[model samples]
Target: MQYLPLFVKLTDKAVLIVGGGSVALRKAGTLLSAGARLTVVAPDFATEFLQWQQQGKAELIQGYFQPALLDGKLLVIAATDNDLVNAQVYDAASARNMLVNTVDDQPKCGFIFPSIIDRSPIVIAISSFGTAPVLARRLREKLEALLPQHLGPLAELVGRFRDNVKAKITGFAARRQFWETVFNSDVVRDVQANRLPQAEQKLTALLAEPQSLAGEVYIVGTGPGDPELLTLKALQLMQQADVVVYDYLVSPEIMELVRRDAERLCVGKKAGAHSVAQQDTNQLLIDLALSGKKVCRLKGGDPFIFGRGGEEIQALLPHNIAFQVVPGVTAAAGCAAYAGIPLTHRDYAQSVQFVTGHCRPDGSEPDWHSMSRTNQTLVIYMGLMKAAHIQQQLISAGRSSAVPVAIIENGTRREQRIITGTLSQLADLVTQHDVSSPALLVIGEVVSLQQDLHWFGQRAQAAVFAQPLTHIA
Candidate 1:
């Protein structure tokens, strides 16, 4: 190591900063957060520095730098833009045997700041010693997503019980084992779910005796076709799950992320296909959870939005099963964004309506009269099958046949296809392009923006019908 990594205590200590611009402001903020009393000497300061001074966090001395300014200072930072002035500060501090840092000058820096992931009380610092700052920042970003937000609170909670745990558990090995069990148990789940009281009670019970195995179900949404769009909690649960129950709507790429050894069950709920019935699927989840297996019920898009997740959860109610819901980017939002079709724009649409093309068992229809209003974007999921009926009904309800529409096939996936036309040509466009399942129907004036704002896919592939769609009387 070129330089030793040390986290020093700066509480109420004096630090001299020889610059008052943006660079000085940045270093001052970090120092103040560490409880350092700052003395900043510079020709001029940023607006924020004045605010900090008013807040009694810093002492600003406006003037050119002199060696006397470093008097009685424990640490020094040269943050001025002028190279000569920065070198002067560094030389003065080095002569006085003080720890000093010259911004952007690695050789002159006695110390350097690292990229910080502040899960407070659980701080992770990544440093390249100024050689690879960008790479270090990227790594920090990755860790930020992986680390749960409840870690700080969990650490504090566990810290408070350490004395009690040491007292009860006889040996070091036993205590270690007990802690391992606590972490692997639903205590982490309870903490993550913000059920602190339940977690505390469970912890107390565990310290008293060994805990019996208990299982939990996580209804995780994998998002529309893009595995990258999966929530952090969803990914964590899928990796930790003992068994994964998934639907055909889940993309193959997403299924690849599940724990490799996990038992997989595909309860097909595709359009017009019933490989496994809904009731059987619900019973399967209930049975798997009862057998003490952490079950991840993975659904594509949001499970609650037209995914029949509500019904499945209602089934688990009588059984008194523990479950968590992780929402994903829905198809309507993801598809419309990737296709460059904004769901709502002030000039085109002021509101958006999401409806299912799949009809209910009771043979009911959506309120087309309300949905047919102008200046509103209509996004239909699984509407490919009933495109003809949708067109006729919407047109009869007063939606113009010439209203713009786009069929997003395999939306957000690599093989994604976008086909555009008018409302009258919706059924024809589907037939002509052979649009399949996993496709979304985007209708309204926003569909016109697809040509100009279309970003994720090739615009050439999206054939906009040149002729106006003929109205059906």
Candidate 2:
């Protein structure tokens, strides 16, 4: 380690700042948050510093920098714009054997502010020894996303029980195991689910009778292709999993977020084909959890909506396995938004329906009467193979043949393709462009808005009636 990292308790400690500009103000805010008693000496000061002085949060010394100002101070921060003044403050602090930080001047800093992830009582500080501060900040952001919001509260709850646990459980090794069991119990799960009172009650009960290690299943949705759209809860669970059972629809980018050493099993299902049968997938999840593994069943889009999540969860019910459902942005909403075509608009559509064009294994057709309703947008998932049948049925059921349509391929991703045409050209558009599975068919007047509202990916290639389908760059 280039720098030995330590978090010092600054509550009620005397600290001196040698500037009063915006830079000083920023440092002052962090110090005040840590309950530091601050004295700032500067010729001019920001309004916030003056307010802090009046509020008794800090003391103001209106003068130029001097070595005497560092007297009796535990820490000193030189935040002035002038390099010479900062060096002078650093020298004075060094002479007195006090810690000093010259803002933005790393070489003169005896101490440095690290990027902090404050799930307080569980704070994480990351420093790059001033070599790569921006990279350090980005890493902090990534950690922030992965850590659950309830971690702070969870830590506080555990801290409250520390004395009781120590008194009840004997020995260091035994206590460590006890705490590990507590973390894996329903107590932590309840806390993560935002049920604090329930979590507390469960924790108390678990203290009386610690249970054996059990497995859990997390049915997580890895929103349409973009890893950034994943929920924090999903990310947390993904990192905690012992194994991940994912689908082809779950983007490769999302799979990368899973725990590094986690066992991966791809039970990927696609349109008109099953890489692994639904029954086999459900049985696999049950078997994995029965083995006491933390299994993550990762899917693309909302699992309940056409992702067969209901079937899988129902199968778990008989086995009495514990599971959680973390919904992702269903492809319809995610795709439409990226294409800049509102699923519903006052002038175009009053409501929207998400329909799947993939027929059941028995080859039974969907209810065309309801799907043919006008003035509402229809977002069809897995409709590429049946585009002609879908278009003919809707048109026969009194829907407009000329309604605008947009075929969104790989929505929300960099290589997304948007092909615009009329309903009459829906199947022709798919065939001509060779649109594949995983594409969404958006049919309604709202599709026309892509002309004016299209924003994501390359410029959409519009298909005129007789011309070859324009190549989507």
Candidate 3:
């Protein structure tokens, strides 16, 4: 490591800035904001520096930086324009064993300033160890958007209650677990929303029941691909998960959002491969929960639909394990939204139905007569293999040949592709477009509206064509 990163408390401490130009002025401003007693020594001062000196806001000595200026100072900045003068100041501070930073000279500095995001009590500093300042700043900008502005105040509130929480929870493990719950509770959410009174009340209520053991499991739905689409409750469950059992379809991006130290077990079932059988997976969940672990059964989409959540819950019920479910944007909903196809509309359709394309192990086709009615939208999940049979059955069941259909492949992903055609032509369209598995097939008049409602596809296409290979590389 080029430097050990640390944030020091400089309130009321002595700090010396050995320049009066913009660089030195910026450093002085940061130190002042931290409540440091700052003294600036230079041959000349900027207009702003002079005004600060006149207003008695800062102490300024109008002279060249000398070794004696390092006396009794906790921190020093060698920010002079002249390289030789800055080097001299760095050497002087080193001799005095004081922390020093020389502007634009990492090799000669005892400390380096990081690109910081100041949320006060919740400050985040990004550093590249003087290798790439611009990259660090860019990363900071990205983080600024992800983190809420009120996080600092929320952190302060948590800090104020730390003592009380510690006193209430005696056991070391129990205390750590209680704080984990608080971190994911509604209290933190309210604090982030700037509702201090509600947050405090919730915390007080939690403290009142310090010894209660109300363990529960949450079947959280992590939406298709994008992690941002995860519901608030799903995010909270992930943060509080003692052990997370996830599936293969759950994207790596969504898995990345889980607590860093939480145990993650892959129980994903590939078509031809199985890491863990369904029965064993169910047993593992029961064992973990019985051991008092707060387990999160994380699935790709709405767990109730095709995810075998019922079987898992059945196992838990026999053990009397408390559990709750958090619904997610199902594949049909996510694909329909991203493909710009409304599942239900006044003009296009009135009712919508979701059916699996895969038939039962008996190898019998689904009854087509019930599904062939008009004014209804049909979303077939995992239907790519049976598209031809489905079309033949629908046509035999009295559905019109001109009924529009759309196949959305890898919906919501960067590689998402949409193919539009009539039911009769869907089998052919899938062949022409080379659409793959994990696709959604939408059949009805609603598919016709997709031509005008298509927005996400156009953007995805534009992104693909606008960038050259070298740009992405």
Q: Rate the local accuracy (lDDT) of all candidates.
A: 0.86, 0.86, 0.82
- With a 3 Å backbone cut-off (N, CA, C), the pairs that clash in candidate 2 are none
In terms of TM-score, how similar is model 2 to the real structure?
Answer: 0.61
Clashing pairs for predicted structure model 3, backbone only: none
TM-score per candidate? 0.58, 0.61, 0.71
Q: How far is candidate 2 from the true structure (C-alpha RMSD, Å)?
A: 9.4
Question: What's the best-to-worst order under TM-score?
Answer: 3, 2, 1
Better of 1 and 2 by TM-score: 2
Index of the highest-TM-score prediction: 3
Cα RMSD to native, each candidate?
12.1, 9.4, 6.3
Instruction: Give the range of the ten consecutive residues with the poorest summed lDDT in model 3.
Output: 464-473
Query: Candidate 3 lDDT (Cα, whole model)?
Result: 0.82
Query: Mind giving the per-residue lDDT tens digits that candidate 1 earns over 288-345?
Result: 8887678999998999998878988998889999999998899999877767788999
Error of 1 at 155 (Å): 16
What's the number of clashes in each of the models?
0, 0, 0
Residue pair clashes in candidate 1: none
Model 2 C-alpha lDDT per residue in residues 252-340, reported as the tens digit of each score: 88888998888999996888778899899999999988877789999999888988889999999999999999999999988787777
Q: What residue runs in model 1 are displaced by over 4 Å at the alpha carbon?
A: 1-181, 184-208, 456-473
